[model samples]
Target: MPTGPALRIDLFLLAGLFPGLTHAAALGAAVDYAVAAERAGFDGVWLAEHHFSAYGTCPSAVVLAGHLLGRTDRLRVGTAAAILPNRHPIALAEETALLDAVSGGRFDLGVARGGPWVDLEVFGTGLDRYGHDGFAAALDLLLAGLSGAGTVAGDRHRFPFREVAMVPVAERGLPVWVAATGSSTVGLAAARGLPLLLGMHDDDAAKAAMLHGYARAGTGTPRAGHASTHLALVADTVEEAEAALRRTMPAWLAAAGGSERIDGSAPPRRDAGAYLEHLLAIHPVGPPARCVRRLAATVSTTGVRRLLLMVEGAGERRRTLANIERLGREVLAPLRRLH
Candidate 1:
């Protein structure tokens, strides 16, 4: 349970609007969305990284965060996740340090051990290399480098120490978050006391199980926060919300992997109607009152202190931003009162 005020609200921007979209347009929209989120009083703005797909245009979240920081004032910018296995820890540490310095210590570093079989193939890297041990090594290395401790020597590589400190270390150490999907990764994150960034695609049951496992594993030190990301839209009525969701769910589902049953047997065959309902089930989408209730229930059930809302979908950027503003003003405010 969060021992403070209402759960902190962060806005997430999926790099591109949908598959087959223009990269330039997506980048512009992402920057615009970050600015809008800041104006809406969001605590932070998260950018997701994906490669070799229209699923996301900004393949490098570090660079995207740099751009966003220059554009927005007082908004914490970060990668929803930068796949750690694809890059060396030293370089990643340098980039993140620079981001923190340039952003005036407002950069949050969220890392993951990549995702999907295809993403690994695109990078020409095998998951076997980074499975669990490599992830742990990378996490330790990044943290050590960020803390300006010493050269990090892992099972894979050894860094020569020559008084090389990762530049621009913030007065306070960076908040490191790990993106966890599987049980092993979740347990590792908890054991390390790193914040957990729950993936966007998992269902409610899987989310609950993961959270339970994390809680059980996280007994020692409480060094990290827990956050979950979900797509959301607020409208005048459930019917209107469903209609908007219906327009975007098919493409997103197809991109994730068509119609194949997920772990919980949710997301009925990749068809239009089924996919829309599946998305709504996993997200908060509806009128303000209904969405607030759903969000509160999700928070209570998952025990996540932070909620990252994905305001961008396959719909028009204007509509997405408008919905986010509506959520902030109407939905989130009342939910805060309840809390």
Candidate 2:
């Protein structure tokens, strides 16, 4: 369990891609937000990966990290998750290593087994074969390769050498994070002593159950981290913030494949009211003082060592960025002082 002081906060680039925003615009916003987060005393900024979908534009998070690295001075840039199956271990290792080197070792790697059947089908990658066992194997190889202990080789690709090391290894090992959505994956990550990055779509009970299972399987007091993301807009009035959330919630939930439905309802179905309830359940959305109180409560209840704020929803980019700035200045700052 996390002890003493509140968990470190990070600003997540949740709205990496949207219908109105172009890929270049999204990337630019991400880079700009990285600088903003650093200036606002954030611990890091995380970019997500998605493919062939307007939900997110970042098909290659490593490349995005490289761009962000050149733009920011002290901020640690990382992928909220890079889908492992879409990438070869050696290539992934090399790309991450290069980014780490360029950023002067300010890189964290978060990988997931993959998400959404549509994405997997588009990539021609089958989740049938790349389930738990394959994920563990790939993770083992990825970690070993990243840590400079293993050689990568196969019929299609090879890093051929007796004891070749992955280049640009961090002075300390890069923190490898596993994005776990299910209990089994959470347990696997914990049992393997890896940090877990819980996604935003999970409900309170589901999240708590996953974390509890993780604790049960975790060994030797390993550190745990998680991020609860939703449409956050901290205005002077809760009504204004809620109104913004209402506008963005439907589209945002739709893009997430309508997974926010938790009332025994089938997914991919949009109900504005249900979605708003779902968003309120997961995110800290309100006025600044209220937002701070809510966030602190979430941290205490969840036992997550990190909190990631996603001020950007499927709303206007400029408005979202302005909200992010206000959140950092008003909400997070006071929370930090309280802690």
Candidate 3:
């Protein structure tokens, strides 16, 4: 089993696009956040992709990954997931290999089936189930291309130039993870020997069960260890932490596709306060010591090698910055010690 602390940072940060914030500002903040995260001693930072919504602004995670990889030399940059079905497998493989070359092999590609439901509609993915048949087909094609397995094509994947070699091949195998949450998806990833990029909402039991099932179902050694991200904040007191959550979480969750559109046509932004219980129950949202304990327990329980904390969920720019700094300086040390 994996040992020692491997705390990382994940940002789907949209504080810049909250109701009162400017979209340009949010994008700028995202760039700065990546730079700052590197400076603050984060292991890696993953960018999220979404479209046609206020949830996240970046549609092209590869573009952002290239930009971020250029900005920071030490911090590994990855896509929390780049929805694979949105683009062709060969194109994705070619671009991924090129980015890996440029980044000195620091990129980790996370592939996922469409989600937020709206994204599926937007991407025109034919998969009836998010983690089932269509996604599996795309993944097979993508992996084959990445592995330089040219001169072949699957029935579901129609491509050209069978003799043309997939160029800009990675210096080493480019680490790829299947972003999964459901049991079937988890089993699928395991069966294929692909590592998992698990979602944030699952509590300990669900996460543990996934691991158990993976061990039972996986075909071969997984390429990389599993990773997960969730809400994490550190304050001086529990009340202060709760207050910060009350201020920022509703907007954050809504941005995460947690709510629905009431009018039957668009998203419904629900009350952040209404979800507080759920948040507090699952995340490390308290004072520094409490935060460390929760994180340590999670690490101990799930054996998740990479734990990405969503400190930017607080929404307010200044508060988000402060939380990032403090968590890096404060909570991380104790958790590492625990590990």
TM-score of 2: 0.85
Candidate 1 minimal-lDDT segment of 10 residues? 256-265
Tens digits of per-residue lDDT for model 2, 97-133: 7787777888778888874345445556556425777
- Which is superior by lDDT, 1 or 3? 1
Superior candidate under lDDT, 1 versus 2: 1
Ranking by lDDT: 1, 3, 2
lDDT of 1 by residue, 240-271 (tens): 88787677757765664432221324443446
Q: Top lDDT: which candidate number?
A: 1
Instruction: Point out the higher-scoring one by TM-score: 1 or 3.
Output: 3
Candidate 3 TM-score versus the reference: 0.88
Q: Which stretches of candidate 3 lie over 4 Å from their true place?
A: 1-16, 116-131, 148-163, 255-274
- Residue 299 C-alpha lDDT in model 1: 76
Q: Which portions of model 1 show Cα errors greater than 4 Å? A: 1-6, 17-20, 116-127, 150-163, 203-205, 219-221, 258-275
TM-score of each: 0.87, 0.85, 0.88
